[model samples]
Target: MGTRKTKAPPPAALGRAGTEKDLPDHFKNYRHVWVFIELERGEVHPVSFELLGEGRRLADQLGVQLAGVVLGPPGDSTRRAVAEAFAYDADLVYLVEKPLLTDYRNESFTKALTDLVNTYKPEILLLGATTLGRDLAGSVATTLLTGLTADCTGLDVDADGSLAATRPTFGGSLLCTIYTLNCRPQMATVRPRVMRMPQRSNKPIGRVIRHDLRMLEDEIVTKVVGFLSDGQSENANLAYADVVVAGGLGLGAADNLQLLKNLAQTIGGDYGCSRPLVQKGWMAADRQIGQTGKTIRPKLYIAAGISGAVQHRVGVEGADLIVAINTDPNAPIFDFANIGVVADAVSFLPALTEVFIRRLAPGNHIRLVN
Candidate 1:
């Protein structure tokens, strides 16, 4: 005789009329928050860890887990990235490894990430605001048809358990906090150094799960041709710089930017320009300082002829101490500036440069040319 199979009992109120024990699908099950771990040239970018730190906080608030998504070529580096993610307080890590992913193309990353999100829904997604990050985030958000907030200055978990992303609006004159409403995964992009770096632990514990892209050569359209990086001599390295001197339209004309450079030379600092200067073609896009431009965290930030617009405020707010020079005493910069000098940038800049040059050895520094 065959062994008798036992039947299991059904749910308690399965056959009851007007039963109230069943919870709605939306309230029953949901996963966790995830960060897109960014790696460049086989190296992990710091911003990825920053996002992980932030994701950890959000996950804690939502009573869920924090996960990191890393895509790269299979090797020790990939494993290392997963381990580091754990150290950054990630509860779980999902990784995709393939040769086609060895280089970052908008197509490969977007496809890999979207596929993962569809399979395992996450409440939030975060990425750094680097050139490559910006490229990928925009495409991914569009592909998923989800609302994305870019250049967010603030992120938090609301009491109702939603991502509150704050960003500058109306040319940085005001701030706006955006909510995704019904979007599955609320997305946002933050600059490289906007958030504080997380502390790493010696014993980081997390689970790692490997994922297969299931994509073939024929599936991928774009090929990695080549990559060009800045030379050591020509690199801006703005975020790491100890001191920076930036000028704005208050300098008056293209010619006046030269004065700003001269001041930077005397102070032994890197030189940069504001958005207006870039708009006027007085400088390249790399030199612009504002919300839409570079987010520099220099030890000392000196601004000349700048009226301190909100957009510009976001860029340089990372400075340890900000010194603003403008003719208008009511300039917005004065509100947050550590020190304020109300004077014409053209005259004040040159005078400040002269004082710095006199204080230092004549030939010890490289003079910034106009």
Candidate 2:
């Protein structure tokens, strides 16, 4: 079940021209929307593609160019990232290559990106809010002395061509939109899965603005010691699941979580809980779903006994469908839920799990024809 948007985003001047009365004139010439295309060891993180999808929209709204910025070592790794960027809707790619950038170092990356922004100014810059992205964005923003909004869930352009970065605030108590009114190259960071991935096309890359990184390996303070990969774990994957079943305080007891688990396992989905569940020791921190936890955009979400607070709402707002089951018809979850069931989850969850088990039994496969 997918939840509907119960409330629209807060409005403001909605345009830079309206809000930039006192803005410095020196920052006015910046143009184009740029997304940092992250590449490591010949692989590109999916979040970069997601940001390209979002950046494309802002670029269209502003009637400006959408470019992907790639900082990596020269070779197949960097070239692949640039090619994929074009396929994901980037009009052009900004390629800055150097041996020192072969691995992600806060100092080298920060210097390289900041130099690029200063040299060929862009109006807006976007980066994925991952480990490497967060570190690099912070350093670059600090160096450029521009305003930066982090962990943004939404991005848009206003009438006067400003980056409107929307993210949850006050510990996810509410949503807020922030703008860099007087700053050049407004910056923002978005977590993985927060934005939808764009469809890939055969459209070839138009142009590549190649730049040189003025740095030496010895100047970099931190060094990559070794490369180690963690074994695959379920907790790390709750955000990307196609289906998710989550329990909340409405369950009344920890044992009740089994009902949600049963339903998820039967459907080959993942199970999670609200923030309170983690505080109460009913679930692990990794299993919590919300702004402070993992942001999910599953195809279908089943929230049982969850109150659907603003914080939790921001995380799941991207789900294709949301089904809420709770006894309180007046709960906030009901306002946004696509399908609301008024019943005690403690009793109803078990019954629903039983029904699904029977219907999905082996040899009873459901099929659809296009």
TM-score of every candidate relative to the true structure: 0.83, 0.85
Error of 2 at 240 (Å): 1.9
Which tens-of-lDDT digit does each residue in 136-230 have in candidate 1? 98898999888788888899998777789987766667777777765667899988778877898765756787788888767878887887888
Q: Could you say which candidate leads in TM-score?
A: 2
- Tell me the lDDT of candidate 1: 0.82
| Model 2: per-residue Cα lDDT over 1-370, one tens digit each | 3322324433544454355575577877889999999887678988999999999999998888999999998888898899999999999998898888898999988988999899889999999988789899989998999989999988887776777888877657767777788888999999989998889999887899999888888888899999876446544578889999999999999988888888898888898999999999999887789888888899899999999987788788889999999889999998888999999998998888887777778765563111
Model 1: number of backbone collisions: 0
TM-score of 2: 0.85
lDDT of 1 at 106: 85
Q: What is the C-alpha lDDT of each candidate?
A: 0.82, 0.87
Worst 10 residues of 2 by lDDT: 1-10
TM-score of candidate 1 to 2 decimals: 0.83
